[model samples]
Target: MTQWTAEQPIVSIRDVHKSYGQVEVLRGISMDIMKGEVICIIGPSGSGKSTLIRCINALNDIQAGSIQVEGQEVHDAKLDKLALRRKVGMVFQQYNLFPHKTALQNVMMAPIKVLRENPAEVEARARALLKKVRLEGKENHYPGELSGGQQQRVAIARSLAMRPDVMLFDEVTAALDPETVKEVLVTIKDLAADGMTCILVTHEMGFAREVADHIYFTDRGVIVEHGAPAEFFTNAQDPRTRAFLDQVL
Candidate 1:
C-alpha cells in the first residue's frame, strides 16, 4: 500500500452535475482522489462512468459544480488546456493510434510536435516508454501490423511518454478479445504497482479486486457505495450495490 501523506487531494470533484440536453447523466457527484491511490469504478452500462472521467480531463463539460486537478480548476476558461493535458494522461477504449505512423512515431508525436521537445530527446524517451510497456521490438511496426493487445500497449506507452502526474483509463480493454484482455490488464497492474495514481472505469471485477485500493459503485449517475476493496466488495450496505454485485460477482 502507498503511504499517502499529501495534505490535499490530487483531484477533487464536488457537487458535479452533467447532462445531455434533457437527460441528466451525473447528479451531484462528489469525490476526492488522493495522490498515488488506485481507484476503480464499477457499474453497469450507461451509468456515467465514462462521462465522469472525461469531466476530470475537461474533455466534457459539466452543467454545475467544480473539478480541480493539482489545485487548478479543470473547467476554468483561462486555464491552459495544453498544460492540463500534459499533467493528466487519458487512455480510451480504442487504441486511437495514427495508422500512418510507426509505434515509435506515434509515441513521439505529442512531445515533439505539441510540446516542441528536442527530437533526439523525445525519440530516446519514446523508445524507453515502448520498452516500459513491453513493446520494445514492435516500435518500428505500424498499428495495422500489430495485434490488438500490442497496439493497446503502444497507446499506453504514448500516454506515459507525456509523464503525466495522473492517469485515467476509460474501459481500456472493452474492445479487446478475451485472450488479449489479460495482456493490457497486466500492463496496468504494473503501473499501479509502481505507485501511479490511476482512475479506471472497468468491468473486470477480478482485476478491480486485485488492483484497486478503493472501489466505487455508481448507479443512475450517483455513487451508490464506495469503500476500501475489502469492505466494499464484501460488506456493501446499499441495496443497489449489493444487487449489482450479485449479478456481476
Candidate 2:
C-alpha cells in the first residue's frame, strides 16, 4: 500500500456548486486531491460525475464556490485559463485527435502553439510520450488507422505531453470494446503507479478498485461516500454505496 504524506493538496474544491440554468448538476461538492494521489470518482450514469470532474479543470463554469489548482484560484479573471489547462490535463472518452494530423502532429501542436515551444523540442517530447505509451512506431499514423484502444493511448500521450501536474480522465474506456479496454486501463494503471495525480470518472469498478488510492461515490449531484478503496468497497458506511457496489460488482 502507498502511504499518504503530509504534503499539501494540489487540487482543492471548496463547496463547489454548479448548475446549468434550472438544472443543478453539482451541489456543494468539496474534495481535496493530494499531490501524487490517484482518485477515482465513480457513480451511476447522469449522476453528475463527469460534471464534477469537468468543473475541477474549469471546463464547466461554476456558479458558486471556488477551485484552486497548484495554489492558483481557477476562477480568477486575471489568471491565464489556458496556462491552467496545461497544468490540468484532461482526456475525454472520445479520442479527440485531429483527423488531418498524424499522431505525432496531434501531440506536438499544443506545445508548439499554446506553449510556444520550439517545434523540434515539441516533436522530440511528443515522440518520447508516444513511445512511453507504446506507440513508438505509430507516430506517423493517422487516428483512423489506429484501433480504439490505440487511439485512446494516443489521447493519453497527448495529455501527458503537456507535463500536467494533474490529469482528469472522464469515462475513458466507455467507448472501447471489452477486449480493447484492458490496454487503456493498463496505460492508466501505469500512470497511477508512476504517482500521476489523477481524477478519474469511470464505470470500470475493477479498475477503480485496483488503481485508486481513494474513491468517491456520487449520486444526484452529491458525493454520497468516499474513502480508501478497501473501506469504500468492502465496508461502506452508506447504504447507497453498498447498494451501488452490489449492483455493479
Candidate 3:
C-alpha cells in the first residue's frame, strides 16, 4: 500500500478478485494506471483482461480488494457511482448504441440525463467529439445506418462525451470486419496521441505495440508479465507471456 504522491496513479487496483459463484475469474490482480498512460492488456480469451477493466469502472462488483479512480474508492457504498462513471468511461466490443437514437442524440444522452448538464452545452461537446472521431457529418445518422467502423467511432464519441479521466476499451475491434478494423484502430490511436489514459483489451498486437505506454500479458486471471512495449514484446520475462507472444506476434 502506498500513499498518494505527486505521481500517484489515477486508477489503482489492489489485490482485486472476482468470481461467479465458486469459479474464480480474477485472482489477486493489482495494477496502477498513471495519468496519460495507455495500458494494453493482451492475453488468451478468458484471461480476465476485460474483467479487470470492468472492475475498474465498477461495471461488475468484486468479492474482495479495492479499486480507486481519482482516489475515490470504487467499491464504497456511500460514494456516488454515477459521478464515478463520469470520470471513467467504457466502450465495449459491441457498440451498444441505442438504435432509436441518432449518433448525436446517443452521445448527448448520458451527460444530459446523468449529469443534468445543459442540453445546449452537451450538444456542442457531443458534436465536437463526433468530429474528433472523424464523424462530423454522420452525427445525424442512426447506428443502423452507419458502417461498423462508423458505429464504433460513434461509440468512442459517446464515451468521450463524459470527459472521462480514464477510458476502458474491451476488445473494441473483435466484431468488426478486417477492412473496417484499421479505421477504428486509427481513431483509438488518435486518442492515445492526445494523451488519454486508456486501457484497452485488444487482440490487435501490432496496434498495441504502436500505441501502448505499458503492456500486460495475463493468464488464468493473473498478470504474468508487464513492461514497456519494446521490453515486453522483445523480452517477456514469463514463459506464458513468451508463448502468448509467439502465437500472436
Candidate 4:
C-alpha cells in the first residue's frame, strides 16, 4: 500500500476528453481528488458524470489528456489494467451479483479467483465486510433471496474485498426502491466515514450534500462549478449550477 500526503491528490484527472463516434461525452474535465476525500458529482442526464468516472477507471479510454491514480498513469499501455482495477473499486447502479452464489461467496470470489489469494483469508475478510455493510447474517443467502438493498450492500462488500485505494460509485442507488435506497446510501456513507477516498456520480442531491467533501456540478461535458457543500449548495456562482440546484435541491 502506498502512503499519500494530505496535500497530494490520490486521483488526478487533467483535461480528459472522451467521445463515441464523434459524440463527445467528456470535454476537458479536470479534478484533483485527495486521499480520504469524498467527491460527489451531480449533473443533469447526459452531462458526462458517469462517463467521467468510467474514464478514470479506464473502462472507457480517453481521447486526450490524462488520469492518474496515486501517480500511476491510468491509460498507459504498459500499465496493468487489472492492477489498476484492484486499486480502484467501482459499484454500479445494478447489483451485479452472481445469482448462483451466496452473499459470502459473491464477496469472496474476486480476491480468491482474480488475485489468487488464499481462500481462507478471503472468506474471513468477506464475512467482516458483509457485517460492515450491515448484512451480518445474510452470508448464506443468494442474490435472489436478498432484497435490492441487501444485494447492493453485498456488491459493495465484493468491491471492498479487493482492498481498493479508492472507491467509485456510479449511481449505486438509482435502481433500488425508494425505501431501499437509504440502506444502500448508509452503507456508502459508512465507507466515507471510515476515511475511504471516494468519487461518486449520483442524483441523490440530499445525500450528496450531506456526505461529500466537495460537490462538483457538471453540465454539457464540463464542470460548471464546484465547492464545499456549504458554499456549493447555498451560493452557486454559475447560472447553470444555480439552475441545477434549484431543480434538484
| Model 2: lowest-lDDT 10 consecutive positions | 1-10
Which residue pairs of candidate 1 clash? none
Tens-digit lDDT string for candidate 2 (33-70): 99989999998888899998888787888988888887
lDDT per residue, candidate 4, 114-211, as tens digits? 99999999999999999999999999999999999999999999999999999999999999999999999999999999999999999998998899
Global lDDT of each candidate: 0.93, 0.89, 0.91, 0.93
* Alpha-carbon RMSD of each model: 3.1, 3.6, 1.7, 1.8
The better candidate by lDDT, 2 or 4, is 4
Residue 179 error for model 1, in Å?
0.9
**Total residue pair clashes for candidate 2:** 0
Give residue 167's lDDT in candidate 3 (0 to 100): 93
**Which pairs of residues collide in model 2?**
none
Model 3 root-mean-square deviation: 1.7
Model 1 TM-score (2 dp): 0.96
What would the per-residue lDDT of candidate 3 be over residues 1-249, giving only the tens digit for each residue? 356553889988899999988888899998999999999999999998888898888889999999988888998888798889888999999989999999999999999998899999999999999999999899899999999989999999999999998899999999999999999999999998898999999999999999999998889889889999989988888888888889988
In candidate 4, which residue ranges exceed 4 Å CA deviation?
Answer: 1-6
Assess candidate 1 and give its lDDT. 0.93
Q: What local lDDT does model 2 show for residue 62?
A: 90
lDDT score of model 2?
A: 0.89
